[model samples]
Target: MANDGLSAGAAARRLGVAVTTLRTWHQRYGLGPSRHEPGHHRRYTVEDMVRLQVMQRLTAQGVSPAEAAAWARRAPSDASLSGGSPDASGGSPELTAADLAGFPSAAPHPGASGRSGVSSDVAGGSADPVDSVPAARVGDGEGGAPADLAGGAPADLAGATPAGLVGSAPAGGGQTIPLGPRANPAARGLARAAMRLDGPSMRYIIEAAVTGRGVILAWIHVIMPVLIGIGERYEATARFIEVEHLLSRTVTEVLAAVPRPPRDREPRTLLAAADEEQHTLPLEALAAALAEQGVPTRLLGARVPSQALLDAVNRTGPVVVVLWSQLPGSGSIDQLERIQAVPHPPLILAAAGPGWPVEGLPPTVTTLGDLASAVRLIARATSD
Candidate 1:
């Protein structure tokens, strides 16, 4: 086909790379379609852009330009890029534990199974595996709570479990709603309480919980905010350990029941950490949502070294890296700057909680307090 279509600049923009780099790939690697234009300026076709995009993903995955070019040469046809491949182009179908970085599971799409490695249950093995919410309303931990909320004490959920509901709705209930923003006051309260938590303590609760929708929401909204409030209260004046302990134990149970989402196409490799000089709860909430959205995620937890983060990015090539700081210190700012310098940086750098003193963080760097905001951000990015 003739290549007298898209301009070099447009093609570069679509490929998320510079025009010069595209030109270099075209020249040195024999990539790109034949370029031609009535005005004699190079014009790349949609095919050229598609090839470039495939090359970009391959290169991001650590493939060399030459090897990426070779792979792109055999990539999907141009037709596949136009509203095809499940949730837009170049999106992964399977989200790993690492992809669960900033939001609930993304909506399902036909192409969600495009890539491999996602568990068979998530891929399409059996919808029943995902339908396993307990029949009884599990305690929110406001009353006489047990020690093992999600740590495999059968007694906790045993009463709620029914033999017939194993692969579908509970005996008397309906279908499970996808984990998302709920207008329920309970969800809002959870979000509010979590906003007060620092990240580390919050993460301890989430990572330790079982995977289910209810558990996921409680962790994102309730436990997270409560912890933040406790941290703030501690900063102001000493507080009783009983209050913190109650909050932690209660929230930990909620997270243990939330199930990871089926499959999503968002990039895997999620990163969350307490900012160099900050707390970690906001990041923990973000990570939980990411898991629900089906993005594979990994939380480095509190006090990660800037060098360690950079190395992780280079080694893992995660699609997004989230940095949460309830209180941003000079060290946090310095580390943030260093991360921004990494090549082809993660899709987002987010902060939440408090004390972000920087004047102008990048547009992609966002600060959020609740699960709703994180869900929307990841959902939009995944669809795009």
Candidate 2:
């Protein structure tokens, strides 16, 4: 923060990112520091810091790194330092709709859900219902397209819906995943990128949400909505399976990228999907969330056989084990029973996801209703 500038470490700390990330930005995107001395390493000048902040904010909001760098490089030298702009609050200017004119606005499809409420199952508690807003009519002048996201929709995806549906809506008319009326801008941006099959953009938006809002908030507010919206789209149309798969893959990658506790720290918590359940995004979210709290966990992803799970618990001696099942067919009570009957049973045995039956759970088995509760319960159990 000196008049001269800040070192790479100091700047990374200020931006809440790793020094290597700064290095990457500098090396790949040309957003490096300019201040140099005859006998010292370069430091990030105030202007450079402003540029970096812009880059960080945009990327966090789901803008691709390349595009974000372009905008950051164009930021005014004193945009954040000098008190001269119209809204001179001593920070970067808020990017307006006009500024993001290049990105396509996600138009609402006729068949998309109009409600803007979060489901209780996904929200991790009682559903918070907002008054339903009718689905915006696309192609009509009243609602030409949804509001523009920070990272504009990619060009090819502007009017293209997924291929091979029975009766596909016209291009540019119903190409979007219906996120309801009040979806988060980041969620909308992510959906746009997913529909475009733009992996880099999807990763950028997800990583940004996870970085800026923590695993829990990011999952609840941003990632879950898109996932649900896409699921609904698939249910209604029985199409866009490709979009779902790519988005799921991108989410998995981003969540896996979250840093874990030190190698020396032993993992005491174990997470696994039920015997035939393949839906592990929730579990992945849980793992990342636990990692954020400095907890290490063993995640046996997707369709973990009961014996394999029991063997894992017996070998690792985990204090907490959470089993997830996404559908009734996959929620086998025998899996939970067998784990509980292990010679040295885990201290906390939890059944998560909607698959588990409501009535006949074992006395010792705890139910994890949502991501927030799972993180808190498992983190506490492990810490104990």
Candidate 3:
């Protein structure tokens, strides 16, 4: 056997079992270490360790060690176990598609047919927790329960089948099956538009919009890039208007659907504006972003008179002020400094857009280019 082979004692230590147990099984059950070399010590591969662990979990649940060992010995050789496909370890493999193919019908539950006395069907029915619980309820923070792997509720029954199974079972009363975040054509279109805008700008906007779903990778690699490409076409030529319009509409709808974070119950407030700033898109985007982060923002909308902003801040006692001038004109920075001087002025002043010149922006104010920075700055201001 190879010298790398673990001694029986070493194998037992690795498996957290007594060495005597390992020797007893090896001697009696014919599971003795393999003698890779004619007269040398026997060796065991890492796969053997995993099989042992699986066997251990089973035995702890009242299975006889002999039966569990038998299952482990047969599992590696069983083609039904998916050809012992490589797993994350790169040593012990993942089950092959062929292996999983026989599941759901044949396996019912793992080791269901074994003599361990455990039932194959859950709750004596066809339902699995993946289907029985509401997708939201699964991870809905009530008591820290984890949601199912699929995220939302079960797949659509219309699409459910042996070859193409979809929706799971309905949770509770069985009258309503909540629709999970499955792909919606309209939502995808909006994502496409945001994608076209591209860059960090579109990304920040979409991240704020889709808060609950763990679709970050999908957004970055697929959706955002495509959206950015479309946006580039629009800026390069007017041919993308129709697509842009569709994207904008879908984004608005989807954003509207996302549950707004509960407003801070404390009297603290915030006032934001796009002063004489025709670029209201970024401002609206920021306002929505703030709301998602739990700030109560009163958006003065686009093109507010300078005097009106000063008065509103005074009346609202807002803790912070955010201004966006997409096309900052001459002396706009001076005008912002004047706003910062208002009585008992808000703790933070954030200015974005093109109107304000970079030079001479006051020390009291934060100049931001996109939503992400604005969120961080606002959060810091609030905490302080």
Worst 10 residues of 2 by lDDT: 151-160
- Candidate 3 clashes: the total is 25
10 residues in a row with least lDDT, candidate 1: 113-122
Worst 10 residues of 3 by lDDT: 114-123
When 2 and 3 are scored with lDDT, the better candidate is 2
In model 1, which regions exceed 4 Å deviation? 1-221, 224-237, 249-253, 261-269, 274-278
Question: Which portions of model 3 show Cα errors greater than 4 Å?
Answer: 1-228, 261-271
- Candidate 3 global Cα RMSD: 22.5
Inter-residue clash pairs, candidate 2: 103-152, 159-172
lDDT of 2 by residue, 77-123 (tens): 63443222222223233323322222222322222221111222223
In order of listing, the candidates' clash counts read: 47, 2, 25
RMSD of each: 23.8, 12.3, 22.5
**Model 1, range 94-158, lDDT digits (tens) per residue?**
21233223333222111111001111111111111221222212121111222111111101111
Each model's C-alpha lDDT? Answer: 0.40, 0.61, 0.40
Error of 2 at 316 (Å): 1.2
Please estimate how well model 3 matches the true structure, expressed as its whole-model Cα lDDT: 0.40
Q: How much is the lDDT of residue 68 in candidate 3?
A: 49
